[model samples]
Target chain A: MSDTTDLPAPSLDVEGWTCPAPLRDRPRVVMGHGGGGALSAELVQQIFAPSYGGEALSQMGDAAVLSLGGARLAFSTDSYVVRPLFFPGGSIGDLAVNGTVNDLAMSGARAAYLSCGFILEEGVELDTVTRVAEALGAAARTAGVEVATGDTKVVEAGHGDGIYLNTAGIGVVPAGVDLRPQRVVPGDVVIVSGAIGVHGVAIMSVREGLEFGVEIESDCAALGGLVEAMLAVTPDLHVLRDPTRGGLAASLNEIAAASGAGVVIRERDVPVPPAVANACAILGLDPMYIANEGKLVAFVPREHADAVLAAMRAHPLGTDAAIIGEAVDSHPGMLVARTGLGGTRVVDLPLGEQLPRIC
Target chain B: MSDTTDLPAPSLDVEGWTCPAPLRDRPRVVMGHGGGGALSAELVQQIFAPSYGGEALSQMGDAAVLSLGGARLAFSTDSYVVRPLFFPGGSIGDLAVNGTVNDLAMSGARAAYLSCGFILEEGVELDTVTRVAEALGAAARTAGVEVATGDTKVVEAGHGDGIYLNTAGIGVVPAGVDLRPQRVVPGDVVIVSGAIGVHGVAIMSVREGLEFGVEIESDCAALGGLVEAMLAVTPDLHVLRDPTRGGLAASLNEIAAASGAGVVIRERDVPVPPAVANACAILGLDPMYIANEGKLVAFVPREHADAVLAAMRAHPLGTDAAIIGEAVDSHPGMLVARTGLGGTRVVDLPLGEQLPRIC
Candidate 1:
C-alpha cells in the first residue's frame, strides 16, 4: 500500500496548461477539469447544463434516458482524442465502441445502434484508416451493436491529430430498470468489476517509452456483457460507472457527491494486477486514480450484492470482480480508504489526471 | 452562363492532394471530398460503408431509421468545422443544432432531442464558449428541440482550431411518412427552400474579408419547423435534402444518382439573391457549388408540386422557395441545366470543395 504521509496534496494546479483564467476564479479549462474530477464536474454544472438547459441535461447520468413515443431510450455521445491511436491491446476504434457501449450499458440499456464520426487529418495513410475502421467494426460486433450511421470530415495537416472519432449511441432501456447516481444509498456495496488501472498504464507504457519488463495490455474491452449479466440478476442496481478518464477515485467521488453519501473502502481490497502495481510504484502514481476502460464499479443494495457479484464473476470480463467497499452515513460526500497498515486516509478526487489523454 | 470553351475539365486531380492514386483514383481526401459531392459519396460508399458495414448503414438516407422496441426513430450526426466560429447571421453553435436537425428533418422526422460534443482548444476564451452555448440554446428553442446531453474535450492549443462541434440528433419518424432519395420518380419536381448562395456568401464575406456593399447574412436557421409545415400539407413527401457542403449542385447530383434518374433545371429560374450573385461573380465561385445552412431541396411528384410549393411559400423559412428543376429519363444519374440562351450544359460535381470548412 502507498504510504499516507508520503502522499502529495490532493489539490494542485495542473502543469502545461497555458489558458488565461478569464473567469473570476478560473477563466480557461485545465486538464484536470476534463479528467472527470471536481473540475470536470464544475465545468458541466456551471457551463454545459446551464447553457444547454433541459430536464435531461440535469439527470447527470452516463447516458440520458428519454421517452420517445411510448418507448424509453438511452442516448449518449463521446469524443475520443487519445494520442496514440493504437496501444498494446486496443486502438482508438475499440475505445470509441466500448466507451459508448459501456455508457449505455451503465444506464441498463441494451446498446442497439451507434453512429461513427471520423475527423481525419490530411495525409493520414488510407491503410491506417482502414485498420481503425476494422477495429471499430470488430468491437461493435463483440458488443452486440451495429454502426448504424456515420459522417466524415477532414482537416488540414498539422491542425489535427492523426484522427479523432466521435460516437453517438442509442440504446433501449428495459422497463422497470432505473439506474442513477442518486439511487445510491448508505449501506450500498461498492464493487469493482475487475483489476483496475490496466487501460491507463497500457497507454502510458507505449507513450512514455517505458518497459515494465512485462506487457500490460489495455483492459479496453466492452463491458456490456458483464453489465447484462448483472442486470439479469436484478434491475435494481443503484449505480454503475466505468472509470475511464479520472479513474476509480473520481467515479466514487462523483457518486458520493450525487447521492450525498459517504464511502469507505479497503485499499487492499481493490484489485490491482501485479503489472499495474509495479508500474504505479515505479512511476509514483496511484492506481486508484488511473483510468480503466473495460472495468466497471457498481453500487448495489447490500442484499443484492452477493447475487450481482456472482453474476459478474461468471462473466469473462469480471473474473477479478471484488467488493471493495460500502457506502457510509459518516462524512457524506467524502471518500476515505483504510490503508494496508490499518490507517484511514482521505482519498480525494485528483485535481487533474496524472496522465493526460489516457483514454 | 459560363462559356463551354472556358469550362475546365471536371476530372483533373485536385491540387494540394499529396497522396498517390493507389486505390482506384484519389488517394488522399481533398477539401471537395468532404463537400458532399461525388467525392464525398465515393468516400462513403467505397471507404466508410464497406469498412463499417451494417444493414442500417446501407440505407443511406439523411438519417438512419431504426425500430427500437415499438418506436421508430431517426438518428443522424454531423460535425461542424466551419472556420471563424462566429459568422454573420450564425456561428458554429447555430450550425451544430440546425445541421443535424435539418438532417433529421430531411427524413420527415421532427427532431426532438440532440447530443452536442465540443472539441475546444485549451486557450479559447471562456466568453467565446459561453456565447456559442447561448446561441446553441437559443437555436434549439427556435427549432423546438432540446439539447439533452453534451460532452466537452479540450485539446492542446496548436492541435485544434478554436472549437469544433458535433451534434447527433434523435427524432421520432411519424408513421405514414416515407422519405428517401430512392423514392424520387422521373416526373418529380425539385423545389429549393429559399434563395441560394446567401449562406456560402455570408461565410466567405467574413472569412475572405470581402464586402458587397449589402450585408449577406447566412440562412443558418433550422428547417425542422418548415419541414413539419410541409408534412402537414402531405404525408407522402418524396425526398428532402439540405444543400450544405457542396451546395445545390451536389444535392441534385446525389438525388439523381440515388434514384437512377436525370435532372434538368432552368438556370435563370433558380433564385439567387442579387447580393449573393454579385459576391459569387466577384469571387469566381459558382453559386451552385457554395454551401447553405438553412436551405433544402425537395423532390416531389409533379402532381403535388403546386400544393407543396404553396405550403413551402407560406412558411417563414421558405418564403423565397422556388421550383428549380425536374427529374427526367433523358440522362440517367446526371444533372443538366438549360441556359437562358437555349443551350443545355452538364452540371458536374466539383472535384473538391472550393471553400474548405465553410460548414
Candidate 2:
C-alpha cells in the first residue's frame, strides 16, 4: 500500500521523462536535409523521431513490417503537381494514380489500396471535379487498386490550383523477392520498356502549342502488372525505375550515382519510336531527358536478360522491351551514348528544370 | 505426410484476381454522405472499408486509432487560409500549430508531433518562406512538439495565397483518462480559460481596416500544458475545446451536436477583453463566434470545478479562467446565451465561412 503512493510522484516522473538535454540540437528545419545523404539521416533521427516515434516507426526499414503472416505488403506515397493539369495525352488525375501504383510496383508489390487528398480552388466547377475524380477512379481500377479514404478542402478561388492531389498507396509484395537500387552489378543488362519522349512531347505539345497532327497523348498508365509479370519471370531483376519527372538521363544518372558505376548505351539499340525521335528533334528536347509514364528501366543479369525481355514482350503491358545498355566499371559516374554514326556524347543530370511539373 | 497435395487451391490465387467485379452500391459523389447520418455509415461500409480495410481504419472510431499505445497521443489535422497571412495576435503560422496541438490535447493527449505541408505561391519571397517556417518552429518549440515530416511545392503565382499551411499533428494521451464531447452532462460546469476574441479580433482588426491602433495580438499558444495541469487536478474534466475558426459558437454547437444535449451560457460570466470586444464591435463581429487561439473553453464536474479552476489559474498559460456556462437537458441540440438583460438567443452554427480562412 505504501509503494502504491510511489506511482509517479508527478514532478519526478516529468523530470525522468523530459529530454535529458535541452532541444537546441533539434532545430525545426533546414533545407540541407533534403539532399539524399548524411544530413537527411541526422534530421530523421533527431526531429522525426521524438515526435512521431513509436514501435512501428522504430524499425527504420525501407518498407516496415517484414515477413508477416501469409500476405506481404508494400506501402508508399507520392505527391504530384504538374503545372498544366491538362496535358495533351492526360491530366493530373491520370498521372496521380499511375504514379502511385508505379511506386508500389517498384517494390514488387501488387497495388491494392490508395488514399487521395485533393485541395481545390473555391471556384472549381463541380463538373471539373467530377471529371478528375472519375479519371482517378478509372485509373485506379485499371491499376487494380481501390481508392480509399478521401478528403476535400476548398480554398478562396485564387488561393489554390484548380486542384492538387496527394495520394498514398499500399500493396502486397511477394515472398522470396527483394528489389532495391543497390542491387545493380557490373554486368547487369539495362532494359528500356518502351518509347520515352512520347509522354514529354505530349505535354510540351500542349504547353507550348507545338502541333503534332498525329496526337501523341501522354503515355500514363500503372506499371504494376507489367513489373509483376517481369518479376515472376525473373526475380533477379536488379533495379526498377520509371523515368517520370526526370527522363531516362536523370534516372540513369541517379542509378550511376547510387551504384558508383558508369553506364553507356548504344543509341541505335534504345527503342525511341521514329515519331517520338522526330518530335524530340523538332522541339529540341533531348529524347533521353524526355519523360515516360508507362515505361520502366530495369537491370538484370545478362544470363536472364533475354528471358526477361521475352517475358516483358509477351505481356501486353510491355511490348517493346529493349536491352539498351549495361553497367560498366569504366568512366565511373557518367552516362555516355554511342551514336548511330559511331560518335559518343556524355549525358549528365540536367542542370535546370527540364520540364517543370511534367509528372 | 501431406495434406499439401490433397488441399484444393484457393479461388483468388492469381487468374481470378485479375477480373474485377463492377461495384454498384457506392455513390459517385453524393452530398448526402457528408450529411452525417445513415448514408454516411453506408459510405463507410460499401466504399471506404472494401478499399481501406484494416483493423484501425475499420474501427470508425471518433478519431482514428482507438488504441495507439499506453502513451497517450492525440492526432489531428486542419488547413488554414485566412484571407490574410498575417493578423494581429497571430499569423497563419501561430494558428497552424496551436490549432492542431489543442485538438490533440483536447483528447488528453500531450501534443508531441506535427507535420506541415506548405503550398506556396510561385513568386512568394524566400524570406517569407523562411519567416513562416521559423514562426512554425517557434510555435512548435513553445508547444513542446516537433515538426517531423514536411513537404513543399510551389504553385503558379496566382494559384495560391502568399502562404497556406495544412498541419497534421500527433500527441500522447495517457492511460486512465478519457474525454470526449459525449462526456458532457447536465449540471456539468463550463469553464472559459480566458477572455475570448483575441485571435478573432486580431484577424478582423487587420482584415477590416479597424484601427484598434493599440496593437492587439492573438492569444495563440499550445494549450497542452495548461490542460495537463488542470487535468492533473481534475481527471474528470468533461469537454475541452479551443473555440477557433467558428469561435465559441462553433465549438459549443459541435459539443451540443456530439452530446445530444443543450448548452446555456451567462453573457456576464463570459469574459472578453475590452480591446477584442471593441474590435469585434467595430467590425460587426460577434464575440461568441469570433475565434480564440491561446484560450480554450472547458467543462468539468461540479465537484472538482474549483480544483480545476485553481490549477488553470496557477498556470501562466491560463490566468483568466472563468465559469461561463453549464450543460442542460432541455432543448437538445440547442445553444443559448443568457443575455446581460436575462434574455436568451440561440447560438447557431455559422451559415458559411467566417473571416474566410481565418483558421
Candidate 3:
C-alpha cells in the first residue's frame, strides 16, 4: 500500500471530518474528485468510509454483496454526468442502465431490477427527455433487467446540464460464486475482454470536433453475458472488474493494492483498436489510462486460465479477449509493464482522469 | 380518471412520444413537472409510464413491491435538490436517508439497505460535503438501515446546485402486509399519524425570511418504526401514504381515483399545529396542500380505525395521530372537505408547488 506515514493523524470524532489533511492541499472539491482515480479513492477512504463505517462499505468492491432474508443480493449505484447527452455508440441512458448492470455482473450476479432517478434542467425539450427515456428502456430490455421504480426532479435551466441520470440496481448472486479482490494470489492470471481506449477517444473526438481519419465509436455494451460465459467455465474466478473510468490501469492498481500482490503485464499483449491507437497517439494519451465502458479485467487462477479464455472467446462481447499478464510476488501493490522493446516501466494509478466524464 | 376525450390520439408505434399534445400548451418541462401535482402526474402518465411500461411502475405507489429470489422486496428512489442544503431541524442529507426509508415504509417494508449517489458542484467546500455525509450517516443509523454502496460525480461549478443527492432503497416486506392505493374501500376510515403542514411552513419561513411567532422545525424523522407499530395492530390496512410533495390533498386524490372511492375529511378534526395554521393563513396557503415529512395518511377498515389510531398514538412519532376523514359511496373519485363553518369545499391537487425546493 502507498505509505501513509507522512499524512496527518486521523481524528475519529462525531462532529465531522477534521483530520487527514485535505487531499493535495486542495480544500475544496475539484473535478478530479469525481475522476475515479487517486483523488476519488482518497475521498472515499478519508471521508465516506469513516463516516459511514460498515463491513459492506469497507469491502470496496464494484457492488456490495449483502445477505438479505436468505438471499445473496448485489446492490450498486452510478450517476451519469457525461456531457453531450448522446455519444457515438450510446447515450447517458445506456450507461445508466448497463453501467450498474456491469457492476453487479462483476459480483457474479444477474441484475433483476433497477431504480432510475432523473434530474432534468427546467425548459429542456420534452422530446429530448423522451429520447433518453426510450433509450434507457431499450437498454434495460437488452440487459434483461426492468426499470421498476423512478423519481424525477427538475432544476431551473441554468442550475443543471440538460440531463443527469442515476440508476441503482439489484441482482441475485448465484450460489457458490464468490468474487473479491482479496482472493487474488501471486500466481493469478490476468485477462482483459476486448479493446481499451475506444470509449475515451470517441468522446474526445466528438467533444473537440477532431477528425481522426476513421470514425471511432464507443465500445459500450453490457458485459453481463460475457461474465456469465466466463463463470460457466468456472465459478472460482478470483475477481472481475469493469475498467470504466480509470481504465485497465486503474483496475489493475486497485487489485494489486487490495491483494498485496504485484502485477506484471506484457505491453504487446494488451489490445488496442487501430482507430483508438491512432487517436491516442496523435493526442499524446496512453491507451492504458483511457476509459472503456463495456470491457472488463479479470484475475483468474492459473489452473483455469486456458479454459476461461476459451469460454470468453466463444462469447460475442469477448471475441478479442486475451491473457495479458499475471500476478507476481515481487513489488507487492505495484504494477510493471514489460515493454515491447525488452525494457520495463512502472504503471502508476492515475492521479486524476486524463479524460473526465468519458463514461 | 380525468376525461381524456379532448386529448390527442396516442400513437404506440413510436419513434418518440407523438401523443397527448403538450400539457396545457407547454412544449417543455416547467417547474410544475417536479412539483408532484397535476403536471408531475401528466409527465408520468404521458411520457415516463408509456416509455417504461412495466407493471410495477404502473402501480404508481410510493415504492415498487417486487418478488425477488422468493423474497418480497420494496425498491424505491428519490432525488433531493432542496436549496440552502440546511433547513430547520434537518438538511438535504437527512431527507436523502429518511425520504427513501419512508417510501419503503409506506409499502409496509423495513428498509434494509440504501444506495446513495451524490452530484457535487466543483468548488464546493469539503467541509460542507463532510457535514452532509455525517447527517446522512446519522440518519441511516436512526432508521436502522445501512448505506451500503454509493457513487459520486462532479460537474463544473455553474452546472449544478451545491449538491444533489439521489438515494435508492431496498427493503424486505413483512410476511402478511399488503399496502396499495387500489385496496381502499368506500367505508375505509382515513387517519393521519400527526400534525400537517409543519414541514412546508418551516421551509417557507426560512426560505422566505418570514418570522412567525414560534419556530417551526421540520417534522423530519424515519417512519419505519411507526409503520411497524401500526402493522402490529393489523396488516390489513388498505393503504398508506406519506404526504410529501403535493401533500395530503394529492395523496387523497390519488387513492380516491385508484380505488374509485370518494373521501370526505373534517377540517376541524385534521390536526394542524397552531403555528402552522397561522403561517398558512398569512401566506394564503392551504394546510391540505402543504407537505409533511414525518407524517402518514392511512386508510383503514372502519372496524379497526380505533385500534390503529391507539397503536399509532402509543408510538413517539404518532402522539398527535387522529382520525380525520372517511371514504364514502358518493362522488366517487373526488375529495371533499367539511369546513368548520359547516360548508363543504372541494380540495383539488395544487397545479404546482407553492414552495419549490422545500423537499
DockQ of each: 0.44, 0.06, 0.47
lDDT of candidate 2 over A172-260, digit per residue (tens): 67766677656777888999888787787788777878776677888898898898889878777877888765478867877776777
TM-score of 3: 0.94
TM-scores of the candidates are: 0.94, 0.69, 0.94
Ranking, TM-score, top scorer first: 1, 3, 2
Q: Top lDDT: which candidate number?
A: 3
Give the poorly placed runs of model 3, Cα more than 4 Å off: A1-24, B1-24
Evaluate model 1: give its lDDT: 0.84
Clash list (residue pairs), candidate 1 = A21-A27, A22-A27, A23-A27, A32-A352, B32-B352, B32-B353
Q: Write the per-residue lDDT of candidate 3 for residues A1-359, one digit (tens) a residue.
A: 13453332222111121122357465577776787777788889888887775888888899999988778999999999898789899999888989999999999999999999989888777778889989998888899999899998878778988899999999999889999999999999999998888888889889989988988888888888999999999999999999888788889999999999999999999999888889888887788888899999999999999999999999999999999999999999999999999999998777667777776
RMSD of each: 6.1, 15.8, 6.5
User: Model 3, range B107-213, lDDT digits (tens) per residue?
Assistant: 99999999999898887877789999999999999999998999988787789898999999999999988999889998899999999998889898888899889
In model 2, how large is the Cα lDDT of residue B226? 93
Interface RMSD (one decimal) of model 3? 3.7
Instruction: Please report how far candidate 2 places residue B61 from its true position, in Å.
Output: 9.2
For DockQ, the strongest prediction is 3
Q: What lDDT, from 0 to 1, does candidate 3 have?
A: 0.87
| Predicted candidate 1 versus true structure: per-residue lDDT over B214-264, tens digit per residue | 999999999988999888888888899998887888888888888899999
- The DockQ score of candidate 1 comes to 0.44
The TM-scores of chain A alone, one per candidate, are 0.93, 0.80, 0.93
